[model samples]
Target: MQQPASTLATLWQIILRLIEKQGLDAEQFSRELGISAEVLRDPTARLPSRLTDRAFAKAEAVLADPAFALRAAECWHPSNLGIIGFAWLSSRTLHTGLKRMERFSRILGSRFSYRCAMEDRGLRFVYNHGRGDWDVGHAMTDFSLSILVDMCRTNIGHRLEPLEVTLRRPEPADTSPWRDYFGCKVRFGADEDSFLLDGETANAPLPTVNVPLANTFDAILTEQLATVFNDDIVSRCKAFLLRELTSGEPSAAALALALCMSQRSLQRRLAALGLTFQGILDETRHELARRYLDDSSKSVTEITFLLGFSEQSAFTRAFRRWSGMSPTGYRGNSAFAH
Candidate 1:
């Protein structure tokens, strides 16, 4: 089963920056939204998608501007989007850059995706969510479209306007801002969210394109797709567990709370994926045991504590079952091999 949708924590940076620019309390606002300080500080972390939608809604409300999220997007940084940002920057053309986004859109959020195709007007880019809504109030839709145009400009080394843009957002009272922002035809109350790039603009070779770097990114991103965010809930669980194991005793309920799911819900999702809570716990402990045993300085008792085992005896039994050797024996063998 696919992991639940989450928003990239870095994507929230712009909204938080905009809030601070307005002289509001970013810390208080983040706390109110259930965003932890740790999540905000970690560039690679992710958060519940609703928290992102709520932050955007607050931005719109605070400024009395429905399109405030678009303004917030001006703060977007190349590094904010993570590795895909660099891959997009080094793309051979606007079209290839977009193709990279099309493939790794999940890095933005599990729900976010795009369709890149050719149409009569130009090469089309339509935004779609895994679920129906883009965000609670569709504020994220504007941010996404705004960032799309921004990305095109940065990649091509100019503010090249879209050939045309269509938004599902209802027409706001004023329209000029939309026009000024996109610098192209803007359609409101549209059937879907999309934009187009003319054939010439789409294929124009980019000066920033670096073939070697782009290929390297492609390989790394391919591995990420295979292992990281490709709907593998088990991997997510193990990552959280690895961080939490030595902090204190860990349990399925605690894991569920961290994952934003109920214990029953987590169990159901795991079962759907042909997994169980105990299976994941044991597997995580086994993997960590091997790593800890490889470190000669770490004693068997210390390893037991780190893996959350009740006692050295228990850890020894489990390690023997997993590796056919005691923790001490495994450590000796590893040290000798080195």
Candidate 2:
């Protein structure tokens, strides 16, 4: 996919703090950046990702520092990333935190889809920008990656160094800042951007783990992310479908009402998009099943109903047809494969 249209408002909050610390007024900064003060102040609001990118560029220009991102990214708190941060902090292990991140990262930013794939030796969290070129600039990428690494380190109470840090940006003349911060061989001019975590370190249980707290935050993040993407007809319908799965299969009328539209109009709109309600529901179930399988918290039997399947056998058969494996088998393989 290309970059998401918007990013979480919490990102702007972080940048607001950075700019304020530099003796700039928040309102002034918002005006100067052509961002709205109203939008910047709202916790649930999503700023245009391009606006935040502009802030990054403006910050660099104001500071006259090519490496301003390094300064702005320092000393992140758990609450800085909103619920996503809290969820990660309360996860049972680094692996669990990563699962929460893979699921809920859209709450923070969606420009890059985060994929957590396990290696025999370690875990790889990839920043996949997807096909076609979209420049996020080196500063934004560096700032985001640093916060991620810092968040992991804070959660585990360990200076958990990655096995490697790869970037697409060109090598700077002074590589010491990147090298010293990552505490690894930071590879510039790499094929893609990623962090490689040591398996033993990532899978180890953490003292900060709190399952109930983490689950609570995860649920909120899901609902919040849903509302964030609910502007469009397809997204609104899809969000309703995912929530509907928990109770049982939802009807077209119910989904239409949820979107405040009638069934006939809903069908007409969907048809215009070359989609059918059944097709959308099937796709939603398939995607939700794969996601639910990733979390060790939910059981196989529970996932069946969660996808609105009447029986475990039905779910298994459907899953086999979709993924060519049983739910259990798919769950097991997901840890070892992408």
Candidate 3:
């Protein structure tokens, strides 16, 4: 199932948290990721979906801690920390909500899986990525951890710091800040990625205002949250365009009919988002071309046909317009640079 774009909001939330923890310059981070700092600050900024993956990976490298991503996710808003997280908090007895989070997280995405268990004196939360783990980059992992932590904290009405934060990647120069914010021992090069919480701290009571209000908020938040993933028409349309671009056959009318919408309405909605079907098509083609050129052993002719180009010359012209170089030249330069 397609996850909501709000998942991206969760990513931005994680980025802000890192800023708070490390005091790293936002502009520098943006430059390192080849994005604009202004976009990072703007909650409504429309990011190219692929860039989210890239940014997270780069940020993880710079921060040197895998949990940095999760920390950022915890601080993201449009959250249900009060509702979804409150049930465990309001229980008369001690209970960990980590498993509950794993259950309901499908409203988020199925790209990753989570498992939680009660340990000897604490709780452990493990994150496992799905197939095409290529997409399971830094940003996604960080956002996942952040949301889980935030949910736990909000449920209990107190900041429940983790006992330990572990990462798959090696430590970065910013490792000290991670330790400071987590207020715990931080480990890198671990067997698996996870966060641990002390059992005593796990059962602590939180300061929530109204348990009843939490129930009401949960319903409201759940409905609003569903909208994030329920728009299948839009996702299908995007997918169709992506697949057809190799045939150079992306068409608004065809996509609209396939989506059971009028072309006019589709165009208007996309316009509101500062995108057009053509722009999406071109961007998809550009991204795919870059990836193929970089990774594949295919000839220029084969790639041109695969991208739906009528001829090599046409593909060359478009490639030059997109990247300011012929495909072969770009590939040569990339190989040389590497």
Candidate 4:
């Protein structure tokens, strides 16, 4: 399947960093991933998701680190953090930064969603991997949070450790390494995934120079961020698609009207982006179906109805096309397979 433009942009960034750090040329990494070096240079170039998986696998094989992907977080620079980091730096305090993170997190990435709340004596940053695949979602969240913590230290000129780091994966037998890295407590196999911050620590002051300069940086980063399409249109369409699909039926006409565009224009623009209305619908259905199947104990038939399929047969057919097997077969092959 075609990879999303955002995915490609991130892959480009990762490859660039790896090349810079390992003192290897792009040609070498491209040979490992079995792609041309030319293709990697273009930010807009498209590749299959499987290719990315293969590239990371090859990197792991060479690096001899199962956690190579996670370790990639350390390479993230301040500029790569984009608008999120800029906003955090501009904020008056760490508390404000956390609030902005909770509010405008879509600017960070669409794959993961976050929830922040003040508990009895601490602040909990709960992150939900909204992506369908558990492993991918978990990896993204882990890397993102790790980088966020590192950035906090950089911005504040002090190490502000989390009270507890909760993970969805099982606890490894050797916990000492994690304890050393996070500089606090680590809990695994939690009911929900979150990073806990002490209330006092979260309210601490950051050592940012020139708040006005930080604001300027935020604006520049916002404008520089790469997107698959225009931000406003994409955000609106995605929101509408998600809402309509959750209902019994979703229609393109209704969506077009809601977006203040005729159905014909909508189709034309989406086509220009190499997508169709049906493609978006199917993508939404497939993503939601996978999430429900993995995260919930709902029956297949119920999930079909919940995803707005008129009949179980139609849902089953679509599932096969998306996953190369029946819904039951896919579920059986999944990590959360029941």
- Reference-based lDDT, each prediction: 0.76, 0.75, 0.59, 0.63
User: What are the candidates' C-alpha RMSDs?
Assistant: 14.2, 4.8, 20.1, 15.6
Alpha-carbon shift of residue 248 in model 4 (angstroms): 40
Pitting candidate 3 against candidate 4, the one with the higher TM-score is 4
TM-score for each candidate, following the candidate numbering:
0.66, 0.73, 0.45, 0.55
Best by TM-score: 2
Q: What lDDT, from 0 to 1, does candidate 3 have? A: 0.59
User: Any runs in candidate 2 off by more than 4 Å, and if so which?
Assistant: 1-4, 20-31, 34-39, 102-104, 110-113, 117-121, 128-136, 211-216, 231-238, 251-307, 311-338
Q: Distance from true position, residue 133, model 3, in Å?
A: 7.6
**Number of colliding residue pairs in each model:** 0, 0, 11, 0
lDDT of 4 by residue, 242-332 (tens): 6666477778899899878999999988888888888878876775676456433578988888788889999999998987788887766
- Candidate 4, residue 268: Cα displacement in angstroms equals 21
- Which regions of candidate 3 fall more than 4 Å away from where they truly are? 1-49, 57-100, 129-159, 171-175, 220-338
> Mind giving the per-residue lDDT tens digits that candidate 3 earns over 86-168?
44444321232454355445444435567777789677888765423343453465566656666566656666689897866
Superior by TM-score: candidate 2 or candidate 3:
2
- Per-residue CA lDDT of candidate 1, range 1-338, in tens? 65777877887777777687767898899888888777666767888776666777676677766666676557788777878889898876788788779967877787778889988767899887544644444677777888888888887888888888888777878988878999998998887788899987887778887755775575566556545574667766776777677775589999889788899999999999889988888887875676565445668888899888778998999888987888888766622211
Q: Is candidate 1 or 2 superior in lDDT?
A: 1
Between which residue pairs do clashes occur in model 2?
none
lDDT winner between 1 and 3, please give it. Answer: 1
